[model samples]
Target: MILTVHHVTTYEYDAPMRGAVQSLRLFPSRFDGQRTIRWDVAVEGGLRGGNFRDGAGDKVEGWSLRGPVSEVTISAIGQVETTDTAGVLRGHREIVSPFAYLRETSATWIDHALRDLAETAVTGVKEPLDRAHRLSRAVSDAIAYRPGTTHAHTTAAEALAQGEGVCQDHAQALIACARAVGMPARYVSGYLFAREDGAPHEAAHAWAEIWVENIGWIGFDPANECCPDARYIRIGSGLDAHEAAPIKGIAQGDGSERLDVTVALEAVQQ
Candidate 1:
């Protein structure tokens, strides 16, 4: 399947000040099941800077905008060909050790409730792969998918206790649970080509991937209760959402900032 993606982000400042800088991870991933056909990223009134692929296999580019600028717009347009690998992240080159993801983040720190949840979900399961699947399902069952219930800083333990959140919360919670049970897991961020019954979010999507001994990192979206397939486009990943965000930047100014993002994805014509 071929998927086309368009993502646009705009930042409006209350007052124009001095400068701004951004790190972009807006390119698609190059892997066996996913191929980048064509891609482009542009920033209005911004200067492009250093760009490179990180050890985690994500493309990073820097951008700088100068002066009393009140607004900056970033746009990404691309096409990618993808094949279903049952959510297995095969043929992706990343030298980072899977164990590196075991360390917890502030957003994924495990508490007593999280530890108990992880333990209860994987009890009596010996196989690591099965344990992961069961845990993903357990998270989906525990957290209801409701928008606006949780905020960006909401931790996994807090989300679990609240029992409702968006995809980010689900992904973070799953990562926390997987790590608690001794399975290396990371967060994945990318576009999902939505169908009538698919990808149910208004913006970009996120999921969790756990390391299966021989399989490497296998994607799991507990919010959707399935593995990623051809409809999913691989972009970049990190220990959690903040690290994997498509765009991260700081605007040096006395002005407050307002961010608006719009994303559109669809299947290309055969």
Candidate 2:
């Protein structure tokens, strides 16, 4: 399948900021599952800086904007060809060991409830792949998809306690549970084409990837209760959503900031 994406993020500050710097992980991942045809990222009134591939094999780019700047806009446009690999990440070069993902973040911190959930989900399940599938299912069963029920700062434990959240919550909760079972897991941010199942999901999506002893990192979307397929476009990953964020930036001022984002993804006929 061929997919086209248009994503724009704008930040508005009530009071002008002195300046801003941003790190972007908006480029799609390179793997057997997907190939980027053409991609471009631009920031209005900003200069592109150092670019490099991180240890996780993610392409990172830096940008800077001079102020008194009240608003900043970042745009990413691209097309990618994807094939279904049954969620298995393959042919991706990375130096980071899977064990490194075992480190938990605040967003994916495990608690007694998460531990119990993990134990119950994987009990009697021996295969690491099966254990991962079970954990994904458990998270899907535990959290009802409700968009506004949680916020950016909502943690996995809190989302599980509330039993309602979006894809981010589901991913974090699954990560927490997977780690509880001694499996290496990380959060994945990406884009998803329209679902034939009519499930509610944004074009931008988040999921979890668990490392099996022999299978490597495999993606599991608890929010959709399935493995990623051709419909999904892989992006950068991290221990949690905050770390996997497509865009991270800081403005050198005390201005109150508000953000707005819009994303459109569609399948293009080959």
Query: Against the correct fold, how does model 1 do in TM-score?
Result: 0.97
Q: List, residue by residue over 1-270, the lDDT tens digit for candidate 1.
A: 988889999999999959999999999988898888899998999999999999999999999999988999999998889999999988888889999999999999999988888999999999989999988999999999998999988989899999999889999999999999999999999877762265466548899999988778999998788898888887899999899999999988799999899999888853
What is candidate 2's lDDT per residue for 1-270, written digit by digit as tens? 999999999999999999999999999999999999999999999999999999999999999999999999999999999999999999999999999999988999999999999999999999999999999999999999898999999999999999999999999999999999999999999998865396646999999999998989999999888999999999899999999999999999998999999999888954
What are the root-mean-square deviations of the candidates from the true structure over C-alphas? 1.3, 1.0
Off by over 4 Å in 1: none
Error of 1 at 56 (Å): 0.7
Pairs of residues at least 3 apart in sequence or in different chains that clash in candidate 1: none
| Window of ten residues with lowest summed lDDT in model 1 | 194-203
Per-model TM-score versus the true fold: 0.97, 0.98
* lDDT winner: 2
lDDT of 2: 0.94
Which one is best on TM-score?
2
lDDT of 1 at 243: 90
